[model samples]
Target: MTPGPAGTTVPAAPDAPALLRGSGLRVTDQRVAVLEVLRGAPHADADDVVRAVRERLGRVSVQAVYDVLAALGRARLVRRIEPAGSPARFELRVGDNHHHLVCRACGEVRDVDCAVGAAPCLVPGASGGPVDGFVVDEAEVIYWGTCAACAATPALLATAPDA
Candidate 1:
């Protein structure tokens, strides 16, 4: 595992074929391509994946990429994030309780350590939460703010009220 930027040891993401096999999914070019693309890109969307696949292997259909993404999501090989007022995004950083820090100005996203360390925030509300008839397995936490680049430029933030 490598030391992540957030002071967490990040496990090396599995290769595409191995990931698919372990997840009980058959290996395919589309799946491998999608995983490869996501390996370097943290938060990509359907159109981004499709464009990347087509760049690597020309003539791939968007529907095909979406299908492969669906399979990967079902297998938990990838995590999808849907920030407010943003298209759904996907990442290969799975099996962790990390949160995301999204930039309001640029839509940039970065992985952050779980709140209270070791995923203590997973409880439905807080400590000993998910009170009755509820099972909280995950929590989607987003800290929205302007990125350094955007924050550096006051005029940009002024124009982008969303920032």
Candidate 2:
């Protein structure tokens, strides 16, 4: 079954075939379910993904979700981001150097554009070492603050009066 407009689905067993072909990955139920979960959740941890997948497929194991997450991460079809004090969360938003704004209090996440104009955050300073034919890959930059909704709420404001 194809992803519904909102991205979640209770797909048929064979529906994974197209997703696998589109992503250049070998089609498998686990992978498709994992991808679908990530697509729907956008920033779900392994446990959360397992919950979503189980709701659709039933009786999937945690180890199985981890394995599928690793495989899909390797395929570059999904991105893994781990904010400090939070479990790693997966998203289908890949191939871009977009940064994340995380709410310190509630652990909410939102995407933001890069700070320093482009992909790599900073230019190597003269003191910066290790230029021995090594090309820098992707850079993950996380900005920590209160989310908009949290900031507006009275309870959050009471907790962090300075904010």
Candidate 3:
């Protein structure tokens, strides 16, 4: 089990091999390890993933982890979010039009449900029509601010320059 918010514990993720097969991808030890790592550490970067996977399965190449992440991303098994001034992070929370909350001070990230209304929440301007005839499928919103921990720490807040 993984530690969750507020000292809670999250159950282990579903079987990796089954998830891979269901997503029509070939199952491998590397893929399974990568999925397990993401399950335990959501919003992990490529480097973090590589480190964890290597610890689990000795001598995993960095390229191998990147390849696995790419395959998983293409299969829609994982979602990639790139917050400003931070490396791309991966999570298993796919299929939802959710947004993100990024802490500027410490670069911590958290999930936020879709902002008001349905999928493609924010419409184009006052007319509520597509801008320049561009059809919108999803709205990616990132709320940038200080998180609770950062807000509580004066030194951390002071060190982070305004973006």
Candidate 4:
């Protein structure tokens, strides 16, 4: 596991085409390129993905990239996470109850392990919150804070008060 920007460890990205095949997704150039981009740069938005894919594969369209993302998302090969006030980002981390820490200052995102217990976080205190819930199965938690890089800069601190 490679340590991400924030202490969250990022799982090594699996082989491009192989991963797609495992997900039962038709292995295509665009699909491979999109996965490669996300593997190298997790939490990338659609625009960032489009630029990277085009860099690797001559030309690609925004709509096409979105289509690939949609396919990957449906196959559970990729995950779409939308942080409020920010564009939805994509990552390869799936089939787990991992969380994320989004930098409020610069929108940097990092993967975080399940806060308490195992997947789903169904047990009380397992989610770092009140245990009372109606058949909890998945936990989507985002810890918003100033990333180290932004905190050091000081000038870019978000104007919005800390939550």
Candidate 5:
């Protein structure tokens, strides 16, 4: 299903008691509210998250949002990413070895599956002096480009003779 505009009301936050019991979270109004915000606005920055949560739970403090984000990120429930020149953002997609494509002009992010279907892209150029045995869990690859929206802009196209 498509997401709504910022601050748009979605379903009420998931059942607090059941969610907490399943995930082992403490189950507070703030935590549920924070998760709901992330669910609606994946890759939202801290400030945006605060705004969204406040819209749902009126009077939610910025500090409360920060704390909840920290807790969720630590538990691997949320994925936190900070692309260069952009504020850190949080999303609910986790566990999969997904890469990202960040729009250089707009800083928008979208997930991409493993380069060839599974783990490890190209083998590391050099294994930092070969340790005894280090297992590689996941590999992250980011593709930077001008998104369709940015590429379609006349000003941007005019600047690039190649395009």
Candidate 6:
């Protein structure tokens, strides 16, 4: 187990190469490094992944990191979430019907398990005038508000203007 944030001990990350192979992807240094970065830092943007991968494997290209992310996403090894007014972030946690809590003040994101019921938590009622005939496989829920830290600091509670 490795020490996670806030003195919590979390299981060590799975082997990156093994994960790539299991996902039917060719194992490469760049791929491994990208996976490692996501494991360490969840909700990282593509630019964040590129910087971390380059730090580990010197001289890596931005396109290469993007390609690795695309491959991982296709294999369902990683999930991408796009918060409004924020860059798309990637996380290694996939498959589960989880949601996210996004902080409007700091843009901090944390996982929130399925809210009330089973997979695809909220279902469209028969009153589905707009969603008629639409099959809902998954529901993307993002609760936007100030995080605890930001709430404690009133100065940080002000929402920034959308860019």
- The local distance difference test score of each candidate is 0.84, 0.74, 0.87, 0.85, 0.73, 0.83
Give the better candidate number (1 or 6) by TM-score: 1
Task: Give candidate 6 misplaced runs (Cα > 4 Å).
Answer: 1-12, 127-131
Per-residue accuracy of model 4 over 1-163 as CA lDDT, tens digit each: 6676556666776699999889888899999999999988889999999999999998888999999999999998899999989999999888788988888878888888898888775454655564565566688999898877888886787463452
Best-matching candidate per lDDT: 3
Q: Candidates 3 and 5: which is better by lDDT?
A: 3
lDDT by residue (tens digit), candidate 5, 1-163: 2233332223334554565557778888888887777876777999999998888889988888999899888887778888777898997767666677887766778876667755665445377332456666677677888778878896875664334
Give the candidate order by descending TM-score. 1, 3, 6, 4, 2, 5
Candidate scoring better on TM-score of 4 and 5: 4
Flag clash pairs in model 2: none
- In candidate 1, position 44 carries an lDDT of 91
> What lDDT does model 3 reach?
0.87
TM-score-wise, the better of 2 and 3 is 3
Better of 2 and 6 by TM-score: 6
TM-score of 1: 0.90
lDDT value, residue 99 of candidate 2: 74
lDDT of 2 at 14: 34
Candidate 1 lDDT at 154 equals: 86
Each candidate: RMSD = 1.9, 5.9, 3.1, 3.5, 5.8, 3.6
Candidate 1 lDDT tens digits, 28-136? 9899999999986768988999999999889998889989999999999989999898899999878787888888877888888788755546666455766676867
Query: Which scores greater on lDDT, model 2 or model 3?
Result: 3
What's the TM-score of every candidate structure? 0.90, 0.78, 0.88, 0.84, 0.77, 0.86
List model 3 lDDT by residue over 1-163, tens digit each: 5656544344456799999999999999999999999988889999999999999999989999999999999999999999888999999877667788888889988877787988888887778888898888888899999999999999999998663
